[model samples]
Target: MVILGLGSNLGNRAIHLKRAISRLSRGSGAVLHAVRLSRIYGSPALTPTGAPAAWDLPYLNCALLGETTLEPGALLRHVQEIESSLGRQDHRRWAPRVIDIDILWWDGCEIKSDDLTIPHPEILKRPFVLEPLRDLIPDTILDSETVEAHASRAGARASVGEIAHSPDADIDVSYPTLMGILNITPNSFSDGGRFLEPETALMHARRLVEEGAGIIDVGAESTRPDGATIDPATEWARVEPVLHGLRALQGEVRSLGRRDPFQISIDSRNPSTIRSALDIGVDILNDVTGFTQPEMLEIAESTDVPLVFMHSLSIPVVKGESIPPDRDSVEFLISWAEERLAEFDRRGIKRHRLVFDPGIGFGKTAHQSWHLLEHVERFHDLEIPLLVGHSRKSFLRTVTEKPSAGRDVETLTVSRGLVEKGVEILRVHDVEGHATLVSRHHSDRLSQLDAGAAVKP
Candidate 1:
């Protein structure tokens, strides 16, 4: 176990922390693996007494927990080299710098050398460090005090608050991720009745996660065009059991030594379903309604679940209707999304907690659906993660002339293309194939990067 602290108070604080994390993961001959990063926290600068208050700048702080095979001294040297490469200039103590990396604790080994110390002395005293550290390792004990207790005591004098993470604090969507579709509706386009039962849904969900799904998108009501829309009570009845089962399965996985957290995304536009899902601890709310209801906004204020605003012409999509081909669909969607984003901003929803889906088949013809996929990267300008659910949609049917069950190949093709264009989340029914493609795509890119770096002057 290697625990490290990263802090930056000058020059693109978030970028500095993110870059350092990447370098740390790749450096040291690939000795480090299984990295767990905490959400960034903004902490007021710790200045000595009599220092000028105007000169102080708050630091963006985060903790990193990873498994590294390198010895402590070698690991320290590797990190020092990373900091130097990231432009850490020598400065007076506590002064703002581009990047600062410190080894908080190393493998429970005590070392008292002039160059390095095993457990950082300031861990117990600084709320900034304790807060992020506690998030990553809540059971950590330092100087006979738990990290949580230390953070609580230190938070009074040293204020620390978590900033919104780009996609989410708990989820890692830095690369193309697999969001497995778990539809419980009898009328859903694919795999509907198969998972309507709680026991069957739990088994399938466990299989999805085991097959490398980063998220399980649970939908009780069918969002398919012309599909039936059930009442909130019916929707909850189909969803509540699955959520509870997955939560229990998560505990079982953890007990069996799997530490990766599986995120739950509830797919519904109903406010009552949203409330119930939040109460059961859903990580994200995927609304096909684009959050039009006042009740939706009210829920946003009441809970902190991240919102997914999908573009659709109607709440329950009307069948056989497509945006007019004569009309510029992309332009209309851009304007419509901008308006929705503005409304969310007005409602005090943080930008980081919001993501947009183009609603591939919701209100678009096969051609119009393809238009959205081709211009998907345009949504990047919105400055939030983009989720594309092109899996087994009708557009693929138009291209391949195949049924929904036979479109997995087309789904992988579309998914790989979206991943290349930097789509953050790929919601698909075929988790294994999508996961494999993403893994290979990233691996090949990394290989090219390494080869290019080796030849550079």
Candidate 2:
């Protein structure tokens, strides 16, 4: 096992760290295979006495855990080459640089050489290093104490901040945002009849927001295979009151000083329902049928709101129907998405306003769903946002044998894997559980790091 510390204080710091990790994963004849990455953190630069003010710029830092086939010395030289390739220049100690890679630990091996050292000398004394190191190997022993213990002590004395979502940061490095599911149908597969009443639905929407949902996907008609189909008027009836209540709720939330209020997405495929939702001022449109309908295409052309285009074989999916056995599911979805993008482009609909969902569990067997998820990275080639709605789906229930309402844990497990693959959004039933998982994985120990203090070295 190998652990490396990465930091950047100059020139698009997040990009620098991302590029370094990419290069390390592929360079050196494939010597380093990254297995995990710590959440990115922001910290003040460690500068020498009498250094220029420009050298004191803050840094974005993270830790990478991986396996290496090369020895410690050879690994050191390779990383140094990577640093230089990313525009790091030989400069004075603690000087601001484009990128910095330090070999923090190498399989408990101890060595002290002129060029490199195993188990970085200041791991225990630096919060920036200890915090991210603990993220990867919390219980591993370091100088007679666990990495977690050292991190606690170091954090108690130092100031570190998580790299929170900002306008300029690349979405690839940002944590996956949550879209809480709000099904207001009596016969939906999960939580059926629970929020059929408009009042109940509004309360649940508020709860979802409190639980950390950045978007509330309100769907009146359930699209599950066994779900009952409803007309546009019926769907609008179920959804209208909830929409008004949500607008009022948004006003309430905004009055409380929340700068970025949660967005509202209407999840439906019916044209009338979507038109009514647009008239009601919803922020996004989620179509389960992938906009195959002509009226849906007309709506897309008329609206500028972000649209979620899901790939499914049929609405309220037909059982025993799925991608052909001989077809590659991932490739099939990619082709489908490309064709959709082309059609939208030809119609003058901007590509940037689009998102794709592989439509897990819709017209797919358990095995097919899992296969598509495993290779979801292929969809990134589309260069648009991806939203995955794997929450409480039958595919997960196959593994845990849990009912729809009981599959939150399974949903989170899969959601974490999606987050690692850089999926932009996760549409989920349990917003709180998924939120906690993302917080721990992407911002572990952020509270301590964000506290105003300095490492007592």
- Against the reference, the lDDT scores of all candidates come to 0.75, 0.79
Off by over 4 Å in 2: 1-173, 445-457
lDDT digits (tens) for residues 1-457 of candidate 1: 8879988877546545655665665422444566666656666678899877654876777777778888888988888876765668665776777788899986678888898888987778777788767666666778887777777777666523533223222223235557899988788887769888999888899999988787899998887777776999999999999999888877887798643467789998889889988888888888888888899889987776668889888756788887877987777787888899899878877665677888898889888899889888777656566789989988887779888988999988787678656577789999888767756654553353334221000
TM-score of each: 0.64, 0.64
lDDT of 2 by residue, 1-457 (tens): 8989988888547646765665565322445674566667777888778988888887777877788888998898888886875668756677899889999998868989887878889887788888777767888998899998988887776643523223223222456668998989888888889999998999999999998887899998878785678898888989999999998898899899753478899999999889988898898999999998999999999988888999999888888899987888888888988899989988988765678899998877888899988988677667566789888888885689778889888888898788777677899889889877866754433443344222110
Please give the range of 10 consecutive residues that has the lowest summed lDDT in model 2. 448-457
Worst 10 residues of 1 by lDDT: 448-457
Residue ranges of candidate 1 with Cα displaced over 4 Å? 1-174, 256-260, 453-457
